[model samples]
Target: MVRILRGLAHKYFSDEEAVILFLLLVTGTIFVIWFGAMLAPAIASLIVAFILQGLVSKLNRMGVPQTVAVISVFLVFMGVLIGFIFGLLPLIWTQVSTLAGEAPRIIRELQSYLSLLPQEYPHLVSEEAVNLIYAEISAEVGHATQWLVSFSLSSIPDLVALLIYMVLVPILVFFFLKDRELIVNSIGRLLPPQRPMMVRIWHEVNLQCANYVRGKAVEILIVGGTTYVAFKLLGMPYAALLSLLVGLSVVIPYIGAAVVTVPVAVIGLFAFGWSSQFIWIMVVYGIIQALDGNVLVPVLFSEVNNLHPVVIIVAVLFFGGIWGLWGVFFAIPLATMLKAVFAAWPVQEDIPAPAQEA
Candidate 1:
């Protein structure tokens, strides 16, 4: 065991830079795990700043002054933020409340539909089975209602924190964008003067993950907006809410789409009742999803490394288990960054055991 441990340490940590990098990774992981919630506003601001930095750079390259570029990008960001909070959020919330109010009716209709299964397919489904299924669904719905009530009752503190974040995040994002150089340089001063491994990791991660992450943000907006417009045109109830789900469903690669389909189907069935309108809604939604996967993804992420489906799924599950929604959102980038780190990591070639004496 000691030999194994020693060999592993020697192989992985033989270099000073590798040791420093390892410590930094460990420290960062510990900090995020322990204090991430408390620093959520700052983290959110950092992400917003990072995403907007590309625009600022583009404007600067186009001969705009740095301060002017910063102000322009920040203004656009605030406008979008304000519009989303004041306009979109209320609409979604209203739909959500309406949906909740209609749940019991939907459940009753579902139960009535299910009760016919045994009559239509007596050999396949028994009456007892239908009753059991209905009971299970009712229980689940009851639990969901209880959870919603509890969540609402317990959300006062969270609402305050959200308001605080609204006030602080934009301010932090503006400064982060404007003082990015100062911040980067200050951080650089703390690191070792020579850091080839770190530099290599950063270069690869930036080349691959930055574009991928930014592309995803754009993809989300496009997919969500397109879905909202399509659903509205189709006269789908809860258009905004369903479209938002459909848009966010892009984040988890294969799984999110499949999972979110259930609600869309359920709502569609209840609204249009297996008629031509329901068929049209499903067809349009499917086309949107297909276009997003086949067309938008390739164009947006042409430069990104195509991780295998299994690897992406594993990454989503692992990181999501660790950090919940944020982990899920950054799963691909984090996985890509780890891949870069592993590629650039310094390791001593294993030394063969000494030859045994005759």
Candidate 2:
């Protein structure tokens, strides 16, 4: 066992650079896990700056001055941020509150529908099962309603933190972009002068993560905006809320769409039960999802290597468990980064045994 352990270590960690890289990774993971909440604003700023860096680089490559590029990108970012905060957030919040207010009514309607399920599918569904399911749903809805009320009452502290983030993130992002090279060089100075393994891993991670994150952002906007327009044109209630959910659903690949579909279908049924409008809404939704998967994804992620569906789902569950919503959002990128790391990781090739005389 001792010999085997030593052999494995020597095979995997033979390179000094590999050992240094491993230590760095472990240290970074520990730092994030321990202090993630306290340093959320800085981390968020770093992410935003990382995303915006591509645009800054593009502008610089076009012969624009570095300062001009930074300012231009920052202004556009601020514009979008303002619009999201003032324009979209209010609409979504209103819909959410409205939905909460009508939860009891919706629950009653759902209960009524489920009560009929046992009769309609007597062999498949039992009355007792239907009753139990309704009980669970009612309990969940009650909990959700209570949470909304409590959250509203206790949101002042959260709002203050949000405001702090709003102020600090843009400022930090601006400085990070403006001094991008300086920051890179400063960190580079802390590392060994010769670090081919780390360099390779960094490049691979950057290519995979940067492209994915940017593509996802664009995809979310397109999907969400399209969904909102479709829902509104179809006269669907809670268009903004449903659209936002639909947009964010893309982050979780298969599961999100499936989960969000339940609400969309329930709302449509409640609004236009057994009607052509409900049918049309479902049709439009299906079309949007089809186009997103078949068209938009191909265009946006043309350069990206797609992870397997199972891997993606597992990543979503694992990372989401660890970091909540942010984990879910970045699950794919994080998984891809891990894949890249392993692919680029240095390992000693096994030695071949000398052939015996034939």
Candidate 3:
């Protein structure tokens, strides 16, 4: 057993550097899995800093001083964060409160509409089934509404957490941006400098992740902004919430748009019924989605993240199960990293070239 283990280790690890890399990966995975929720703020800060680093680099390339670029980028990030908190939060809260307050009425209206189903379709739509569905929906809606009310009213914990994040994330991001090289070098010092596998993985994963992240952020903003404008022009209710959903939906490839579409269509139906406004909204929405899928995605995303749809879905399911939303958000990047690691992983399939009996 000992010999077998050593042979396997030699086949895989082969060297102290490889062993150290393996250990670091295992340790990091364990740390993230165990303490991810506890360190959410720091994790969030790191991600934000990473995203902002690109902009800082761009400014630096344009002859701006490092300090000046960092400050400018940090200020822009802070502005957006603060604006979302103060400006958008109140608006979203108002809309959400209004929606929650009207839930029972909406349910009652839906029940009324369903009542006509028997006359509309006597064979298929039975009154008994409608009653059963209505009862189930009412119960679920009641629980959901109660939960929303309780969550909104009991905001102490949430508010405190938000306060902490607001204070800590910006500070962490500022330092991270300013001391970017220093921080990277500090971490880089721990790893063995001679590991070609590690170097290859880092270079490949770093390029893919940087491009994917920056492009995704741009995609989200563009999709979200375009959606907001369209919704606002169409006089759609809950424009901010719906647009935010549409924007964020772009993050999850192939599934997000479909999922968010149900909500958009439902809300539009409730607001406009079978009116021309609803038709126009659907048309415009379709155009936006078509443009996004066909034009924007191709233009924004480089060929670096040419992952298979199945791989992406599997990664989303795996990481999302472990880390929830953040996992889902970083699913593609993590999957790409995994692919890079595997590609660079040493194998023991060397066959002795054509043994010739001399």
Which residue runs does candidate 2 get wrong by more than 4 Å? 352-358
User: Candidate 1 versus the native: TM-score?
Assistant: 0.92
Error of 2 at 184 (Å): 0.8
lDDT of each: 0.90, 0.91, 0.86
Model 1: CA > 4 A from native: 1-7, 122-129, 146-153, 352-358
Q: What's the residue-level lDDT of 263 in candidate 1? A: 95
TM-score of each candidate? 0.92, 0.96, 0.89
**Cα RMSD to the true fold for all candidates:** 2.2, 1.7, 3.0
* Model 3, C-alpha of 9: deviation from truth (Å): 6.4
Candidate 1 per-residue C-alpha lDDT over 1-358 given as tens digits, one digit per residue, 9 for 90 to 100? 9999989999999889889989999999899989998898999899889889989999999999999999999999999999999999999988887877787999999998998899999999999999999999889888877766677778889888899999999999999999999999999999999988888878887777777778888999999999999999999999999989988888778888999999999999999997999999999989999999999999999988878899899999899999998899878878887887787788898868999999
Q: Which residue pairs collide, candidate 3?
A: none
- Which residues of candidate 3, in runs, are more than 4 Å off? 1-18, 113-133, 344-349, 352-358
Q: Write the per-residue lDDT of candidate 3 for residues 1-358, one digit (tens) a residue.
A: 9777766776787757667778888999999999988998999889889889889989989999999999999989989988998898788878877877878777877888889999899999899999998999899888978888788578789989989888999999999999989998898887776768777767777777778778889999999999999999999999998899999998888888889998898789888988999999999999999999899988877556578999989999999999998899889878877787766677664334567899
